[model samples]
Target: MPEYDEQDPVDISRPNPARMYDYYLGGAHNFAVDREAADRVLAILPETREFAMRNREFLQRVVRFLAVEAGITQFLDLGSGIPTAGNVHEVVQAVHPDNRVVYVDHEPVAVAQSQRLLADNPYTAVVHADIRDHETVLNHPETRRLLDFSQPLAVLMLQVLPFIPDTDDPAGVVATYRDMCVSGSYLAVAHSLSFDYWPGAVAEAVEMYTKSTHPLNLRTPDQVAAFFDGYDLVDPGVVFTAVWRPDKPVSDEEAISSRAVAGLGVLP
Candidate 1:
């Protein structure tokens, strides 16, 4: 486990979305503040844990599909939170040992933990930078060294765009990244949906995130699909995360309960 001291650039006094996500995934990297905040969210939405798990499962499934079906060997995972089981590297590496993965995040604790976890893997690296900074992330020495822009790769934005508001032009940022990739490259995105299933509870849960280091910005399905403007969406297009190429049968209730949508697009 990675240890943090006062010298580390981490603020434990406030709730961090990365730490809260770790808490949701039942990881031990979170602190009391994070747990408390996550508990409040759980109180508002009892299925918060299930949502996190489903998001993770979606990430793993998509990466595996990119590696196996799409013939992709390189991955750039933006806003990758604290390292946990079934990471991008682990999922893709399983398809082929030489597959490379670069994880990018601005969270100090997440970067520290990822660095520690990937220390022994030559095919994987962690970049301590925000996803919105295309120059920094694309120009980082580790990223350039591990990933070749000339070849096809997959850019993963799983459950992270919710932190980016419209003022930042999240769609434009995605377009910038899309322009950086070559033809045949892929982009996979998963974003929280603003649905009316549980309006009161969901609104409260979204509000709770405003107090965290990263606030949530729920988007409609069409808004989420807009992120893939320059690419062709794979079969099923943007749909509930649970039904996006799920490994097993998913009932209508289960799909509706996902509370988020995901899709993979390929540059044509």
Candidate 2:
């Protein structure tokens, strides 16, 4: 656990997980409340910041692979949080300027921040809608305008599923999106592991998210893998975040011991 002053001044009035995540990534978009909450979470799981950074790197790699290798130009990023460097648009656009991206997030701050950051870009948009509301997200004017359903699109759900409980039918949520995609499209999902690597620390960290707007409902790799039904997984199916088509060498311990797991699946 990382050291922190538990009694630090905090604005509990509007604590948010997205902002806390921004704080974890060393971004200035977070508020005092987010910093305080993130600090507490860090105190319990010191590796959490590393895990978040790794997840971000994974998302970048996935987007780049989809754009450069898969030849995919359209991207739909669900639960896309506060904008930071190396965002989906920035990464994929670097590969091809014609690439289009649509970011979806329920957090108003995330949406607003994205709007401010993307206002100058014509090929990107930010939709303010809950990720579970697939219909709303899929049919939104901005989404429709930016993405062409006829072409292959890469759908990213990075570090977002854990906030959705089984009762909400997270699998069904994914299925809805999967069904909407055309053949040759891809779904890239990244979810935190429940117990395999660090059970105690994970449970405690989950407890912290429960106090925030989005409660963490961590699941096993099998449960998460089940969400990929109807799509063919890419190589290293449902492995740790660092192990899926890594850009550099990754140790077995580092790959398997991560609190998060991720994989990419292609529509058949």
List runs of model 1 lying over 4 Å from the truth.
195-200
Task: Please report the TM-score between candidate 1 and the true structure.
Answer: 0.98
Model 2: CA > 4 A from native: 1-12
Q: Write the per-residue lDDT of candidate 1 for residues 130-246, one digit (tens) a residue.
A: 898899999999999999999999999999898999999999889999999999999999998884644347888888889888899989999999999999999989999999999
Clashing pairs in 2: none
Task: Tell me, by TM-score, which candidate is best.
Answer: 1
Model 2 lDDT, residue 29, Cα = 74
Q: What is the C-alpha lDDT of each candidate?
A: 0.92, 0.87
Query: lDDT of candidate 2 vs native?
Result: 0.87
